[model samples]
Target: MDERHDPARARWAVAGLFFIVGIVISTWFTRIPQFKTGLSLSDAELTVALLAPTVGALTGMQFAGRLTARYGSAPIARVTIVLAPAALLIPAASGDLVTAFVGLLVFGVVDGIADVAANAQGVAVERQLRRPVLSGMHAAWGIGAIIGALSGGAAIATGLTVLQHFAVMAAVTVVLALVAGSQLLPAGVDRSQTDRESPKRTSWRTGWTRRVLALGLLGGAAMLCEGAISNWSAVFLHDELAATAAVASLGYSVFTVVETATRLVGDGVRRRVGPVPVVRVSVALAIAGLALVLLGSPSDIVWLAIVGFGLLGAGLAVLNPIVFSAVGHGSVQDTGSADTAGAAIAHYTTMSYGGVLAGPAIVGWLSGAMGLTAALACLLVPLVGIGLFARVTAAAEPAVAD
Candidate 1:
């Protein structure tokens, strides 16, 4: 990295951006109760309204590729810097269902854009710095989520309204994001930063080649499991396993801690082992973890479920990072595509969130037909498939950047 680019600073900037994105989204999650109460919404109505973000997010991601391809990651990231944080006001600053839905839809769109753009920026930082940083960047997001949740708790305790809490956080996020956005690598660095041979592959279509598609599938599968586990773990423990609500809550808590811890150390592990080994190991752990869940399902054992969720977190923690790194590095080398990596990352991210959005609904449908046990057990199918296609992405991970 050139002294002018200040690769180390740029890396932190991206990390900060990641945190900003995570915290803003988490802020929304933490306030669902307020939204429900303030709007006088029924449970079913809230569920339907919550779907707006997912739909809007998908729409936003579909266009982010083209936007980044034309304007570069830095510019798009800066756009998110303003839009995502500021858009927080939309969802809760409403009086009617139609208005709230529109607000959330717009929020989801901007959030989706921010998600892709921030990741693309992270990729640029990795390439410019010539090492692995994506995991750590993701770790920042996790950390931010923790803070967001805690802050939300505080706000609730202090009797702040939803709008008041969101407004304050939104302001803070915009200020912080501006600082981070300023330090992002200048436009075009994602394409220009390279230490390896390049120019062999041309066109953004390279983003959708078989290898990239395979990586996308793997990422989607992992996130699908995450969505299912996150949304259902407590329910499973409380209802299926006959645990107390307090104990049931520990399921997701364990998963979150394990996932965050794994992400914290994942970069060093990836630096030592290659991406292939990292992914392969992830596949094994995820499968073993889910198997443990199945083993405990026959009986009402809460500890078994808790342990299973922890392992599942460990297994799923690093796969998405690996996928993102592979796609970003691949695009850097294949400079022929204007934003080949951007386009590809957008697709991968879209599929990933789609998995999360769809996972719960899919499980619900399956549960109706075959019971929740069989439904969750069905996740193993994708985990095994992830193992089969682990090598598709050409991720020859480089050593840690100094």
Candidate 2:
């Protein structure tokens, strides 16, 4: 096969960008302690500082679609990946809290834009290949996170300064960007044929129709489940379930391991059964898992909660992929809008971030009021919502009764 223009090559290129973003994010957060010490930020200040990326990311997402439609997924993805690691260096070398905030904010902006572009490029490759590759691409991100964490630890253990560590990572990312840029899709590949002549002003109505936002709600709900598990699993295990400290740590590791492994093979499952069945089953599994987590409290079996957490990871492994891919494929049509698929992808992604923000806070607030298990149990409602909305990701929409 001539590899230069092969869709597989393009797929790998996009996947590399996803991997790069993952590594950039994981590296930054893993080294956050250094920022705290170096910048001498108070606890409250640190919490506020941590929010910079989320705010920046949301702001960037608003522009991602227009940027992609104007240029293309490849150019934007390539530019962002190259900038992402360098953005990390901002915080790494920041001399004050304000500077660190600015650095992280920039990093988040790059991250938000790169996310939509890379995924749009991946969807384009999947269209060319006529199969599901998004799952594996996402799985690549999970793998990159593991590698980033390990490498970040290695950098710390070897006594490298934060700036030096980030600089090396940035250098490596720039070098890899050359290879990714060479093979990623061309500038107009993911854009619509009519997009070039369409009026440049994109009103929110373009892709923010009912269905896309509905899909966003579904995606957001799933992400809330994820955020809960990732942040609260350990706390739930140790504090609520009376598990050992070592056991508590295992909860998230198990969730991550299972989630990544499931994603590696999830594309095949989606291909075999179709997305609707996959999503329905996924939500059921997540609900079942959360149920087990709740049951562990009454039965006092911590292992059930552990297994439940793994199931939650496995269940959610491909949901966001399915939601994003569905939007990219235009499976759900809406009112007439000239928005490119990239724009639509960017639109729903904002809601996804909203879920990420709400999850931990909702859980914590409920934990304080009703208790931890009950707070987690509340996730069931959204899990059910996911299953109910599974058809949004399917090829055919149910006909409306006039």
Candidate 3:
């Protein structure tokens, strides 16, 4: 155990919590029909109601920066794990829509908080280890998602009901997450910032004008790819391929499995290629993935789409942490305070999270209007956009060495 490191085991614990949260959130999508029926909501009304929870979520994400900066990542992360998993209890217990909405809102808050704080913790842990480790942390998150999705069938089969089931699972998972995350660094402490006039004096404006914009945009595009799959993959499978709900989800399931596996090995891949090449390769893979999905037929080519999405997941997995790493390095290069890094991270996350929140609905609406094929083709624009951005901003600009 590296003495300066925040116990690798502890970080893994945090990783597990984040993974469970991912599972619960994704599972909720499957449960939306039940939610709609329970609430007696029409399609339009359901959409409207769903929007409210995201509103709360976005608001929480926006403020997550200030909260973490002041309060620290570990405590906030702990609270979010508890809060988010706890939110499961409400929907599990309630038979009505109003209560479900409130539960979702709570879910949103925990989601935002856990996401920001965990990333923050990952940064700290990475610096202490003095090597690339974030990919593995994210891989753990993906694995958690797989476990959650797999369990959904069992939960339904057991006949305990969604509410009762989610509540019990929530309580158990949150406690485990809290226990696992206890020894990590506090949120705002920067292992990379040794030359200190104190980090708190730093401001966001100074950071954004630097290369942080490119980093933020890149992170955003990668996030958009993920959002696209979660929201549109099932639709594409169901409508375009005429598959069952279970089969339709196979699209995302394959993507998650491949993505998780790649991420598990991504650290070595990045080490061999470097950030610029890794990003370039990943973006190219993403473009190919999206293209394959667009062109492939359900009868003979659906597996091709699955393969494409899997490649896309692996390609995209390295990005989120890489962006955060770049921001931390930028601050060091500029000889700026670590607080600036926090602000930069906050900005990048804002763009990335916003993309995810918006990508599905936007894709869905476009699919409704122009057809699923056309909507899938629409995704190509962003892929091209991201590719061009990566090429132009290709150089990592050499970390401003200490």
Best by TM-score: 2
lDDT, candidate 1, at 106: 89
Candidate 2 lDDT over 21-77, as tens digits, reads: 778888887888987888888999999889999988998898888887777788888
Misplaced by over 4 Å in model 3 are 1-7, 191-210, 241-247, 297-300, 365-370, 391-402
> What tens-digit string does per-residue lDDT give for candidate 3 at 50-167?
8756776666766665555556666677788777777766765666667767777777776876777777666655555555667778887777776776677677677656776677
lDDT of 1 by residue, 231-302 (tens): 988887776788898998998989988998899899888878778888889889988888887788759666
Q: Any residue pairs clashing in model 3, and if so which? A: 73-187, 92-163
For each candidate in the order shown, give its overall lDDT on alpha carbons. 0.80, 0.83, 0.68
The collision pairs in model 2 are none
Clashes of each: 0, 0, 2
**Candidate 2's C-alpha lDDT?**
0.83
List the pairs of residues colliding in candidate 1: none
State candidate 1's TM-score.
0.92
Model 3, C-alpha of 141: deviation from truth (Å): 1.9
Candidate 3, overall lDDT? Answer: 0.68
After superposition on all CA atoms, what RMSD does each candidate show versus the true structure?
A: 3.9, 3.5, 3.7
C-alpha TM-scores of all predictions: 0.92, 0.94, 0.85
